[model samples]
Target: MQKGAEAVHAANPDVLVILSGLNFDKDLSFLRQRPINLTFSGKLVFEIHRYSFTDGKSWETGNPNQVCGQVVNDIMSRGGFLLDQGYPLFVSEFGADQRGTNVNDNRYFNCFLGLAAELDFDWALWTLVGSYYLREGVVGLNEVYGVMDWNWCDIRNSSFLKRISTVQSPFQGPGYNESRSHKLIFHPMTGLCVRRISFFQPLELGPCSESDAWDYTPTKTLTLTGTYFCLQADKSGQPAKLGIMCTNSNSKWQAISDSKMHLSSKLQDGTNLCLDVDSKNVVFTNTCKCLSKDKTCDPASQWFKIIDSTRKQNTTKSFFQSKQIAQFLGNTFSYIL
Candidate 1:
């Protein structure tokens, strides 16, 4: 493997030479003993694969927080140690059963996601195929772990994708660290995120990792990165977007709940419009009657968790710079072991 890696670099000095982990593809613990002596600059990367099934002793029945702590320790010791060694460690394979009903898988996945986010590890999710052409003489066998539907038309489990989105992008990677300063206004109902695609586009929810960084100011307004636009609301029933200079009170927001789930923005003349997802999945201001009148009222779409980014962020990458790097790394980051 070393010879092959060296040969690849020798043929193309600018290309990154990736080394797969040894010993059931889970053992990078050997790196603690020695180094992968790839003399090329920015050309050495290590990869490891993990599944919840490998060592799921107490994942299903134990306290989730306790299990998450234990599992994260194991992952750091085994493969995540590479990050400290000044090399990127890619989690090449990690996925769960898509049925959303498996107790073991469901628990293990939440634990896995916690570790991924805390470490800011670059990883890939397993699967895209739902039904197979043929497998062991059986046709149309269902693969519940697949991301696609049986007919390969729609996403099989959107919530699963949303949960994984928080880790796909590097909040803290090699170059930038100030990203911890931003907050992810995560919507719990649709399991999506609030992002501004363009200055003219309304603030909408999409995959969280792919979303842009947002600065929730002390003045109570949201500032979108890579632009001068800030979130603005024109009226009570209208959609919000990146516009206006963010000087008005309508742009300001406050936490109305003790748990900090409710983000209430002020309307003109002193009425408060709570931030909620509309029927179109767009974020806007609405009534906050449930907060005081009905405790059990389903106001989840208006619910958002402002997750403080706890890790460092990769330095700001311009489109051309990112494109150049992507060219060297190829079109995809996910790969099977």
Candidate 2:
């Protein structure tokens, strides 16, 4: 395996040389002893496979959460340790049989997701298409596991996509730290993995005073009247208002009416504050920003900043304060018109 990996590295210096079939057993100390043989400038990713049925009935016994937790811990102990040592851990394959009802699949999925969340690992589902020619006499595949149906014309199981979408989405906020590791959002209904901002924080309407109550809505869009302060506060109680909305345009925030505010700009890179002046409504766009190898941004500003000695030291604390401000403002003035 080492020789093969080294050969690949020698051939393609810029490609990731992945070693697969580490299988389910997971004792990989051999990797440590291997000499650096790569003739390339790429990374090495170690891959593993996991499934609910791997241990037979383990997932079926005991408290679901407890059992699943143990399973995840066991997997991590045996294989996940490699990841902690600066090596990448990839769950190259995982999924439940589609023969069962949505309930069973959902339960299994929850457990899978919980571990994925706890570990923050990268992975790929079993497959994109249905109808695998397994060794067991070409077993008719389950619609649940296949992202698409046998004919490739219909989506066999959309909920699967939805469940994974939350796991794959990049939008990170208060109620969604577990799901933030997701880098993409898949719209099951459309079968498209378009980039999106998942609103992790539940909208808080109580923070707004009685006068501001009109601006709060459970829906994503908000309506408001006149200029209003859009504040964001974090866990520490510090608050920061990105800006006060006076006029709506295609650039800043979208104006639906003289008094309503909706998101016109993308929130994937920054917090989008959408408000309407006439109706006193508001929408918080908690989009997650993807950074390039050379780009870095302040979590508070979601904008890139030049790195300086003094700036780097202060960024962590300041970023925390800014997050607190954004959260507090979201909680406090969500309804304040």
Candidate 3:
């Protein structure tokens, strides 16, 4: 390990140095006494691997919430020492089987997310694709640990990405303040991210208009009208535009306008609510009483079911040699004006 570290420093002293913990025993106390070259550069980072299965079988059968707590404790017990010494810790690889048979993976991830949000560590998921080559043949083949397919083409599970993205990238802002009132819509099974902003203001003539009611019966379509306003932005923030989106499908809520109008409605829950613009504020009235009461304005109220039909095909057989692995990362943004 010291020889490797020395060679890395000899080649590029300025480059960030990372040391990996070998085997299952990761205690690093012995490194403190070694005469290894200590240029004392600030770029040295330590890497570690973690998995839900490492905690024990109890995590697999226990209640999700209880299992999550145990997982947190186990992780802390293993790496708490390094964290106390101010070393930068990276969870280089972590994932669960994609077959949906491991309940512990889900609980472990939820706990990992909560802890990650509260800590300063940086991490990358185990993989973005299924399949891997091994000496004894593919180990965890066609597993769901990957975010995309082995071909590196379409996303394997979009809802999974959506859930992680919410905790990873909570808001979008160039001129807008993220601290202000904002909303996010996430699909846990497919990693799609959407953000919405609502501002307090007086009403005016525009696309969003007050309506008696609306309906979303099969071929039925509805329109909403209201005044749109552009929020004044600070020099550091992105200029804000108002818009609206409508649909029962949480994954594909269509936007009516992009930063163009404020008063607008879309068919949701088989009905529509039209915004009546007034000098004081916009008012919402149901076009159809049945749909109105059911069309919740809260984004969190939306739910999604995992759809296996959306999984992409895996074309790469690299899981055999362990030399080749598929990787992909992406970001998407949608705004409802």
Candidate 4:
């Protein structure tokens, strides 16, 4: 494999040489002992593939949290460790059945997504064609994991795309451009974004690009950029408006759930209210409703996706592999986008 990689590098110094994990490309534990040496600089990348069935030891039968913890550890031991090594690692393939009835796949997918969000790892979904033109001796073979419909006219699953879109753009990473110094609050449901016109103004929905920059502290306080105005809540059932940066409980909010879809808080009345928008497009706290249970529930007004609005043009250090450089290199280094 090294000889082949070296020959490829020799042919084109700028071309990326991809090294897949050993044994069905499931793990790269060997790299911990032996790192690859390419002929060129900044053109080596590692690739790995994963699926719901790969780590199947019964993710459905065990406690989701416990199983998720165990599986995450295993993943870290395998290809996930590459991220810590500061080398670009791509999830060359990962997907679940689009038919959406596989319990193991569904559970494992949630766990996988949680890890993907935290690491901001680049990835590519497993299949793209809903039905194959031909495979083996069979004609018109169906690929349940495909992103497109059987006719290839439209996306097979838009909700899945939207669910995965949260990590589509990175929040924190080595290559984050600091020039913008802003974060946009996004709610995928309505596709409307949260923004502010000025200080002491009510935050409203707008184009995500036009959204205001917000600062989310570890303590869960959201303060507007370059201002003392922090997000706080008024009485329950009322629109949450901007107020002075307060040390009280009203300013506290948190991203709850494994997917971090729910931005919720506890009110003085002890009701667990979530940040939501009514049909009138007003921001307020309401009951923490289920997002995936009912598509007709129309909870877009409640979901908030906080994204980094910075330029991300700069690379932090050698640990940081710029996505642009990876793209410039070649398709050998696989990624979703």
Backbone clash total for model 3 is: 45
- Residues 152-243, candidate 4, lDDT per residue (tens digit)? 88998887776676566665665766556656566654455676653334567765445666888788888776656678777667777676
Candidate 1 residues lying further than 4 Å off, grouped into runs, are 174-337
1-337 per-residue lDDT for model 1 (tens digits)? 7789889988988877778887667878887888666656676888888887777656565544445456667777888888887887888888889988776676567556545654567787788898899987999988899999899988999878767766566655456465556666666555567875544456788866556777777777777645445666666777765554478777777776432456777767887777778788787767764453232344456666665563442235578655644552342233311
TM-score: model 4 vs. ground truth: 0.65
Error of 4 at 165 (Å): 5.6
**Model 2 lDDT vs. the true structure?**
0.43
Query: Model 2 off-target regions past 4 Å?
Result: 21-42, 99-105, 132-135, 138-144, 169-337
**Deviating ranges (above 4 Å) for candidate 3:** 25-37, 132-135, 138-140, 150-152, 167-337
Q: What is the TM-score of each candidate against the true structure?
A: 0.56, 0.48, 0.46, 0.65
Clashes of each: 3, 39, 45, 5
lDDT of 3 by residue, 1-337 (tens): 7678778889987887788765653444445565235656577777777777677664445544445445556566666456777777777777665555666675455455545533436677877766555424766456467876766677776656655654353232233242332222222222332112122222122210111111122322221112211111111111222222223321122222111111223333543332221222222322212111222121111111111111111112334322211110111122221
Best by TM-score: 4
Overall local distance difference test of candidate 1: 0.68
Better of 1 and 3 by TM-score: 1
lDDT comparison, 1 vs 2, better candidate? 1
Candidate 3, after superposition: displacement of residue 152 in Å? 4.4
Q: Per lDDT, what order, best first?
A: 4, 1, 2, 3
